[model samples]
Target: MKKIKEVAGNNTSDLVEMNRSAIVRILQQMDVCSRADIAKITGLTQASITKIVAVLIDMGIVTEVGFVKGEGNRRSIGLRLNAEKNLVIGVKFSRHVFSIGVFDIRGKVYTQQETEFGLDEFASDVVVEMKKQIHDLLKKYKNVVAIGFAVPGPYLRKEGRIALVTKMPSWQNVNFVEEFENEFDKPVFIEQDANAGALAEWWFGNHGRPINSLAYFLAGEGVGSGIVDHDRLILGNLGIASEIGHISIDVKGPACECGNKGCLELYCSANALLKKAEEILPELFEEEYENRWEACNRVFLAAKEGNEKALELTEEIAEYLGYGCVTLINAYDPEIIVIGDSISQGGDLLLPTINKIVKERVIPEISGKVQIKISKLTVDPTLYGAAAIATDKVLRKPSEYLVSK
Candidate 1:
């Protein structure tokens, strides 16, 4: 399943970018904070925050709020994001849906949309629709400096060509950067959706985390994972890093699209769950998903409202999901594990149990600090990661964020 959650931080070099962005991200998160607070959160010196905030103010990306005067202290001026100053576009395409999002420099998605079409049809048709969307967005904002796509595979590092995208029909080895570049004549950044979602969580969702390694499980139409180590994305031996969902659990359970038996996708993905529901609960199949939104909502509502059958099915999926997470955690020793997918709509009702299973199954201390969480309902986290991809290419300087692919 592809995660459409867009958040900034798609690049390893991004946080390392001019350091000004680091300061801005810190300030943007807080309504208003003193320079000392910025320094405290970012480990940057007060002098650095002063210099960076100065440049940001000049760029009109931030503004100084009022000052706080305390009994033995001098008045300190607070700063906050100038959210109206600039805008970025986060565009994403998954198996069955399309999204066009407008975000601010703070990486907050202010205006957004989710569009559905045939997965086969979308792969071929997105270009035209995106072109029109781009045209319309540019006409209104005019200064949208960058746009990013949450792709399913790694792009060739230098040439920016997409490669090895198996789930996206006809998109394998396609040079999306070149296509989008020529069509829009703007910088089009692309990144793996799972990686993008993790970045969003690291940056905006779970900021200043005490832990290092994190596994972000994104479930939608297909399943995948993103890993970050020491604030950097782990690209694995061949940039095929975090293919968690494709891992064989049952081995002889069921044939997966990727040619493996009982792949996690067959059991955990929305498609798989819905397919099972059809056999177990034909009543639901009669109505159709109505759209992805309604489908997850219905299941989650049923799970929350104590529908026995729904709860049982949810537990079954959660058990597999938890077991798969165990494998990833054992391999990586991640500090945090974020679950983001259509199934996540079940929210706390789903994750607490998965957390329990993983902790019980994993070695004691190793699992202690690991946090299993559901992404915020409103933020399509991958979108912000796409925004971060745009920010990485355009705003960040060298040495800020680092990555292999």
Candidate 2:
């Protein structure tokens, strides 16, 4: 019910498809429901529900499961989505690593693998390896219907290129659309990492129902935010809206790769935490860390162990993260804010300080109503988000992408 949006279209066929999408989304959430239940939830007439369900059954997208108790103790046929028959591939591309996974429409992951590469690695070579992995997965997962790709923020949707990646300049010119659009037999959909995270939370997250708006705050290699309002992604003109990482927190702060001063990313990102940790807690860095996440966790672990300096460093990062949350609340007015990514591993050590700052900074009336929680997704949010991007599209037009057994 929370996923349903108001249907609008001038064309009758388009309207019908929209209605079908609504029904499918409901089944995706509820798992099983009667036509009467769907009609009541969607506010559509039972006749329309019957008509839509019949077509969906004919298409093999939906099937009658059996009789189930309906509202008022009445008996009605149960309907459900044939989720196992439709699969998607999720690909997450970052500076140091790229991950690919196979997932069904219901967010069940079949398999995933991560490949690490250096900053100096040829972008073309990395992409080639990525394609090879994806091609291999496609061969093994015959049910896969589409592929979803997630890249760093400020990604130009129209141009299909990252306008600017923090440490990776070579990728800025690698047109993702040109490289991926025709590379696979199945349709490939691309979205910025933050937006993809938002979709992952929207579709797969268990944040309770009827979430009018949700914000996903990403604090890892880079800081960013993604917003989902009323079951729709708030994509700006170039599909880069809600990029909270680029928002300047300090006008006089250091210069950022995004050509801005004091961007939120420079302060709360894993790199920022590492820089401060190196200065105050140099002993923790005696051994080289495999990645930024490991280094950041070292600081958090030290804080948990009662190291005063480590606690201070984590508190500072938490304050910056709190500032990011405040900005998210003011800009998007999300019902819930979900903090995720490498930095979120701080867990309990970070929440108290972050929540305190938010309570002090935001008006009580607003702050009291907003719920903040760390992401509990079993899979990496960005990787799962890649699958969600494809899932969102397939659900919108089931007839075109979803295959019948």
Candidate 3:
């Protein structure tokens, strides 16, 4: 965890900041550790560690958990992050659903709920619903530090507006962050859903090991990826770096809403799965499910039960999804590519096919060591991603937001 410290030809203040960051990151990972252990792990001297811990404790960021017995039966007090001292709100907004979560500094979900929207729900209405959820969470808990929104399409971070959401065109031109901040009067972070999923995996999915680089491929309304290299998230011009779903796989195939011919989303998104299901067996959906989301779930369940048509659809999706992985493998060359979101409900049936394609089609030099798998998050990855965004802000500047109120 000492690697979390950034060294930049250290000035005295910079050096101190680096030590503080390293200590906090270590505490975050370990939950609780003795002062001797912190000093040993951070490579900071006893005096430096003691001074920094005192400052962090004064700032209300770290607290003494309890005493631990060491060599010679000596007892030392353990330090841990005051994770519950502040709260973060995470919202995942899609075409037809809004998922809200309240989380603490350690990525624990305090409470959460999901609400479905009507086909004609307006942007203002969506905002109102979000305000209600945030208000309820606040009513139950105090010291909310920030809020984060996980959106479906490319977001212009500079402009603070959604660039486009193909499934919900009305979301375009909406400055969601501004509106959220105005209502809540707190800092709000906006990010593409896939990128959020990526952050969640990097921060929480690694099981205490550091991930130098990885890509999270989120398949939902559309396919997208969040790319991380050297522990940094890569954002292209206008924060639209990994728009993989819009990448055209077929030059002469069906035209897409992005005005591309045969984009990857047309083949592998949750919507795409339902589209094919309706095309092949219209009656399956007409009589059973009330909406496309449920119908898509039905298809995945059927595939698991060895239904012929359902299995065929899974193979088709795996072929295209795996093809997308090839492109990601070649482009980012991540150590692991995690497939998540609603589309991943197909689980083993879909995962094997995608893995097979990446192994067979990717260049041996690049794919030789790449590991691909399904998401391991017990809670929704996107929700954790939202919390990660806020958690990152707090970690970077404890002085700014982690102080006693």
Among all candidates shown, the one with the greatest lDDT = 2
At residue 382, give the lDDT of candidate 1: 69
Top model number, TM-score: 2
Cα misplacement distance, residue 362 of candidate 1 (Å): 0.6
Candidate 1: list runs displaced more than 4 Å.
1-17, 40-45, 69-73, 120-122, 153-168, 206-211, 392-395, 398-405
Query: How does candidate 2 fare on TM-score?
Result: 0.95
- How much is the lDDT of residue 227 in candidate 2? 95
Could you tell which candidate, 1 or 3, scores higher by lDDT?
3
Q: How would you encode candidate 3's per-residue C-alpha lDDT over 88-200 as one tens digit per residue?
A: 88888887888899988778888888888875888888888788888888787787888878887677888877776786777886887678767776778788888899888
Candidate lDDT (C-alpha), each: 0.70, 0.92, 0.82
lDDT for each residue of candidate 1 in 1-405, tens digit (9 for 90 to 100): 988888766564444454875665555556687888778878888787787777667766667879965337878886776655556788876766778888865676678877777646645466777778777887887557678788664444455655544456466545676677767745677778888777667656644545567788887766788887886787765555787777888888977656778878778877777777667766655675667657766776877788788888888888877987898788877877888867778777777678878888988887786777778736676667777666555445312221101
Candidate 1 vs candidate 2: the lDDT winner is 2
Q: Which stretches of candidate 3 lie over 4 Å from their true place?
A: 1-15, 67-76, 281-293, 403-405
Question: Residue by residue across 121-171, what tens digits does model 2's lDDT show?
Answer: 999999999999999999998999999999998899999999888889999
Residue 311 error, candidate 1, Å = 1.8
* Candidate 3 lDDT score at position 372: 82
Model 2 lDDT-worst window of ten: 1-10
Models, CA RMSD each? 7.1, 4.3, 4.7
